[model samples]
Target: MNWDDMRFLLAVAQAGSLKAAARSLGVDKTTVSRRLRALEAALGRQVVEVRGQGLNLTDFGRRLHRHAEVMRDEMQAVDALAGADTGGALGTVRLTAVPMVINQILVPALDDLRATAPGLRLELIAEARDLSLLRGEADIALRLARPTEGGQSVLARKLGDLDYAAYAVHGAAGEMPWIGYETRMSYLPQAAAIARSAAAEGATDISVNDAETLYRLVCAGHGKTLLPRIVGAAEPRLVELPYRHGALPKRELWLMLRRELRELERVRLVAQWIERTLAVRTSQAQPTRPPDHRDNGADP
Candidate 1:
């Protein structure tokens, strides 16, 4: 008998009723009934019997069910193999990363990524919180720190380091108001670092939850705030403060993926692109000398 007929038999055997089987299979009950009859006719034996209140599989039907399950598994394996072979590096890969990295770093490299793998599509989930890779919420992740809870099944690599520098609007100088992360965000390493640095410099008059918001306020001449060097360097209106006393702490950036997904061509390609992009960006980020305070309209 054909696999389609065997599928109906397996469904009916598992569901115990033609109506339930049809519902599960997305077909009419009559269709399932007909298929089962056709399969029995071809096999020349009764595979099922009507019990007191439900359908029961006969001895032969139970044996056939075992074989059908094996066939179904093989079919699934074949489908997966065929899809992978035909769609090499062509499907959408979901990536989750913090907003700053997406906007300041990854977005700049999109053109190169497209050129390298035109068939690959990207779905970016920009949020600070780590998305679940094991649950398939994301195919890849760029995290500031190695994830603590995704288990050993996750594969992570240290892509590069992100350096932070205190920035302010051009000409804004000494003892200026500082912007910092709110207490709610103090749990983050970057926030803690900013808090310590700001404490020694000036009073924090503004507190925000995200780096992008802090960046905007600093650029608007609101207050000096610590930001990733890459972001601060891109803003012409902003100038980096001298960290002569002590350099801001550097955080390591990580590229992570589920171990199972590493085999996919698209996943591997995207991971390589991310690693390369971050490395290049990090290398190109030159340390800028603290702007001459005298030029700006600030008290000497």
Candidate 2:
């Protein structure tokens, strides 16, 4: 009924608890709860179903949220039209990406749109979990997994096949630390390639999960990690441990958006930026040279 109530509704859905939402909103939990109750009562509808862990938005809440987003965008656009610069989109963009891409790729490419679309506000959430886009958890999701199909909503794009190569610290490629992604998430093609290549080169096995962390650890001489060749190339001495003699596993990366927000300008800008950044990197790549010295495969 009110933007305050709708904002509270989004907070509850996203934060998972009134307390959490209050913390995010920088207000008292009781106030958030009271407002939510009042809104539900005003609407004469059960907006949320309470759960042990958090509140789940009811069907009514879900429908209302979609409309709220449309209204939010329209209002934001109107406000921008009234006061915004001659050319640019303005508003917050929520993006969720896994660690490696966030660190190695996303961070560097953030300034790409600054000259063209300076009004875009980016709120990036880096996590490993598959977040819910339907609930407005994020505007765009860069995921490795194939997207869902045939349901309330659906859309897809085959971005490109991302390649992963095993790498270690300088002079340590032949004697790799042989790390794996955290614990349970290991045995993925990336990790498997690392294991296979390391075993081939007579190296030791060390396990880890997050690609960014694993890459950092490996850079610190803790172990070797399977990293995308392009990302790993950012640092020195992280040689490619390609599958077999010389092949990288083709791990496809896809850009997915809620079927609804696909056309939204903010989401589109971020997505296009990501794609453009990757394209630039791909095009500007130079052939890598072998290490200049003998292979001891140990930290200096």
Clash statistics: count for each candidate: 0, 4
Off by over 4 Å in 1: 1-89, 173-175, 291-300
* lDDT for position 299 in model 2: 45
lDDT of 1 at 236: 79
Clashing pairs in 2: 181-208, 181-209, 182-208, 182-209
* TM-score of model 2 vs. true structure: 0.64
lDDT (tens digit, per residue) of candidate 1 on 60-172: 99999888866654564354345463645577788999888888788989998999887888898999777766445677899888666344557888876788887788766
Q: Rate the local accuracy (lDDT) of all candidates.
A: 0.77, 0.69
What range of 10 consecutive residues in model 2 has the weakest lDDT sum? 291-300
> lDDT tens string, model 2, 64-102?
777666665555445434533346556767788898878
Give the TM-scores of the predictions, in the order they appear. Answer: 0.67, 0.64
Whole-model lDDT for model 2 versus the true structure? Answer: 0.69
